[model samples]
Target: MIKSKWTSEQLAWKIRRHGVEMTHLSGGSHLGAILSVADIIATLYTNVLNYDVKNPKWEGRDRFILSKGHAGASIYAALAECGFFDVEELKTHYQNGSRLSGHVSHHLPGVDFSTGSLGHGLSVAVGFAYALKKDGRKERSFVVLGDGECDEGSVWEAALFANHFRLNNLCAIVDHNHMQSLDFNENTLEIENFGEKWKTFGWNVIEIDGNNHQELKVAFKRVEEYTKDENHKPTIIIANTIKGFGIPFMENDILWHYRFPHDGWEYDCAVTALHQIKPEGVEDRYTPNSIENPVLPTEKDDINNDHTFSHTWNTTYPEQMRRVDAKSGTNEKVHNV
Candidate 1:
């Protein structure tokens, strides 16, 4: 067994806290995305995945791909907490010239693939699993995807390929937070009967409350056993997670899909909220919406409201372009989403 330095819960808390700090510092979006998938990443790093920190490229290590690469902060935090690199180096995340891009990057030590465009990561993971199975290696390839990313036809195509090859060594977990970039998933593209779609593709489907640590651990264990069977099929876990899981005000709100904690009130409040989750008794320590702050997009307005749209565009579009200083050989960051 690969014993972790910190328990899954502890790692999850750190990932959440680090996510808040990283997003605040970098003015990066996707903190909500990060929180939704934190526990899944934490559980894998803590108990499920087999890896060597000293030798990240060890051939026997299991491969992990974050298909919803926008949520890269959580995985980066996990890798740092696991000693893949100095945790302090995380401050450079999304900064110009930093290896930590806004999306997951292979330039980092532990990441096997870079994925930001979405939906293509599973294809790469399927290839990895197929190669491992053909070589008769015990190694596995795991992928974490966003529920919104499922709208991509490429994801289903990869699913078909995995089933045809019967790549039992492959496991995929979807962060089914029910929200996309601009609004709730149903309001955008309804992926109803999500698990059934995977089952139709000939995959073993396991649906669970994604934010629950114990359930995540159990789901991973089941997938592990499924991989050992001679006639095993690829498994896809439909992890029904809240869009903004940890912080109370942010939970289930589509506004956070691209909102970062700015330097003042938002940053202070987010840090305070994450700090409330104690190492000993997280449930007792934390209170939902305990801090009295302005509720954005107000109760009267759904995410489609003009205020929400304007806020998103105002916060997201300004950061899209990057400029380089030709003589200084230094890059300047205008904005990052």
Candidate 2:
């Protein structure tokens, strides 16, 4: 594995900044998801995972999977920033015929598994962990999941299987952003006491602030030490995070879950908030013709009109907020936007 010059915090900032740009450039959704999980992804790539940029498929590499694949842009950004591929390829995300699909793709140089379906990634990670344990390999399997994704029965089944065999090499991180596709987890199927659910499945659980780098680092270290024991249970980190974190206006807002930062105030403000300069030449790029496809409309129409046929209602929870400093992009208290 090539050494990373940037610290985990620096890498995280880049991931959040790049994620905003990719979603803006490609008219992709899940900007909220990307923002919520960027820190976790960045921390893993910078501080934990081992891999070769030149040979992503190297056998000695630790396996990393993004179970919450809607936030695939963050992983792509992390890989690009780490030099797995040209960072320039990020601009092609979610565009016509681009390999960087809206969901995470195995076709990418560094991605271990292609995951769009929510509950299956844990299963795949479990398999990898089990195989490595049987082979007596030191490499570990790591997977990131979304809190809403826990609704799937398949995830629990995988959890049971992993614990049954004592797959201590597996590390799962859940981005508990509280809100899922339509509304808050409480409104949609609530999975309260999330950490306990994993504990009940017979896995070791560590709960921490998903956005805080210090907390994440300490949690990862604990995982490493725990796995060293001959008789150890699999570990899962329940990372509490605010949806739409970092961007001031978007923080904890469900609208961003499917809202792309189109060219306008939304795009300009988000880039500025991340302390990044907006990319040039995006105006000349091809945006999807929404009228031709009723399901996908322009961002303007997406905000103004309620196309119930799509079942996407604009639900704003501005009342629910996490104070993130715009300039630093950290979870620091700031005056109201």
Candidate 3:
């Protein structure tokens, strides 16, 4: 793996910032899901996983899967920062002909699995772990799942499989934000004794504040040491996080799950919330489209993909917020903007 200059905290902020920009520009939703897992993704990509940005398909690399694909923007952001792709390409997210889709897509260079459907990622991770073990490979297989996705019976089935085979090289990270879709998980379908349930399934489990980078590093170290010692039990880290994290107005609010960052006040505020550190000289990079940008043709097929913008946006961009270089097409980095 290439050396990472940025620490986990820096990576988390970058992921959150990129997520807000991606959803706002593309008129997409799921910002709450993405923000909730930024630190988890940051920790994994920077501290845990063994990966190379240039050699993404390296056979010896650890396999990382995003089971909760709805929060895919975090993956894209992390990968981009890791040099898997150009950061400027992020603007085309969810746009017509853009490679970055709302859900995780394997078509991207760094992604290992394409999953929008819940309950499948853990199962696939199990299969990968089993295969790696059979081949006598020490490479680990990791999967990130959601607390809400625990409702799928298949998740339990995979849990049993992971324990049954004693896949020590497998690690599952659960983003337990508690809120899912229209309401909280308790109100929707309660999975009481969430941690105990995993323990009962015969897998080693670690529970920690998902947003705390330091705690996350320690948890990953424990799991890594256990697996490296040839301990033949899969491990799962249940990371507790707040939905719409880093954003004051959107935090713990179910409305942000499906809400779009409208062009004017809404978009600006959303970006502000995602950006906790707006250092000097880092002007806003996103230009609110004064005219309605056409949505991708495939959007019509999915009702949740629908987007509508009011004419609340202004045509003129403040000089301070401008990012596009008139002479050169390349965008300027406004302090990692």
Candidate 4:
């Protein structure tokens, strides 16, 4: 166990709970993807990254990019818990006119890059790492990519570039959650010999159970160990993870990739599954609007409500693209309903 004021379990639990709440409240997709990497995110925020949330951009801080940006809520929860923004501001996720778009955005402070298009983030991360190296900065850059994204040629191009340039400051993590959007990765595209693929590209590869906190903590340390050596190269950690990890019902279920749980039975079950033993004195944040007296969101309401949400910069994915969730049914079939 890496030394920290808070245990990795505590951070993981907080991230899992908060992630579910954000996605549930906002009716966002990729909740499974969020859960899958809870432990990894917690480990990084708690153990690896040298960051001060209060100073969103410290000159010497380590930079992390969520290449699988559909899981933006997971990073949002982590940032909030780490004090990047008020925890309450997360409720505005995916809401119209809110700064928190469905996809990851740099508009929010503490976020180094905005990414949603698959196979793009690793390239951006490489650029950041190269710049830091050129400036003779030891501060590292880390990028987390989804397994499904490996199919993109652009991803390979970035990989080759990082290896060619000897970007020892770069560390790439793959969330190898077997299932993709509609089916397993094998159905979409198979990445045979994952570790070999990275080694062949001249990266130092270490495969670990992505959901295991201890493994994640150690894997990052290994990267540091490699960078100090005479023959250093860019490193990649292939993390074997489970989609929809925390909730028993959603585990390994690909449907949750793009489908939001319904407001009725599915929502209740998901929330219940997320908190098997409810935390003491904490109000349930995923409570859906009552059917009888539905409380609809109004644009005029809370326009001035500020909870440390940043408005200093703009991201490529405009706020206009955020999908407004309707208060109704779902085409997604709720299991055991």
Best by lDDT: 1
Candidate that beats the other on TM-score, 1 or 4, i.e. the better one:
1
- Answer with 2 or 4, whichever has the higher lDDT: 2
> How many pairs of residues collide in each model?
1, 0, 0, 0
Q: Candidate 3 clashing pairs?
A: none
What range of 10 consecutive residues in model 1 has the weakest lDDT sum?
281-290
lDDT tens readout by residue for model 4, 1-337:
1233455667677777777667777788888898898888888888888787667788878889999999998888888777788878988989999888998989998899999999999999999989988898888899999998898999999999999989998999999998777677776678878899999999999999998878888999999887665347899999999988877767876667776766655566666665664434444444422133434335653222321213222344544454445665433332231
Candidate 3 residue lDDT tens string, 137-190: 989999999999999999999999889988999999999998887777887788
C-alpha root-mean-square deviation, each candidate? 9.3, 13.4, 15.3, 12.9
Clashes of 3: 0
Superposed Cα deviation of residue 85, candidate 2 (Å): 0.6
Q: What is the C-alpha lDDT of each candidate?
A: 0.85, 0.84, 0.83, 0.79
Query: Which one wins by TM-score: 1 or 2?
Result: 1
Model 3, runs deviating above 4 Å: 278-337
Model 1 over residues 1-337: C-alpha lDDT tens digits?
3556889999898888888878888899999899989989999999899999888999989999999999999989999889999988899989999988999999889899999998899999999999999999999999999988999999999999999999999999999998888877777788998988999999999999999999998999999899989578999999999977888868877778888877555665666667677475333222344345533443453433332332455533333376777999776777553
Clashing residue pairs in candidate 4 are none
Q: Give all TM-scores, in the order shown.
A: 0.84, 0.82, 0.82, 0.80
Q: Write the per-residue lDDT of candidate 2 for residues 158-211, one digit (tens) a residue.
A: 999999999999999999999888778877887988888899999999999999
* Shift of residue 73 alpha carbon in model 3, Å: 0.8
Task: State the weakest 10-residue window (summed lDDT) of model 3.
Answer: 302-311
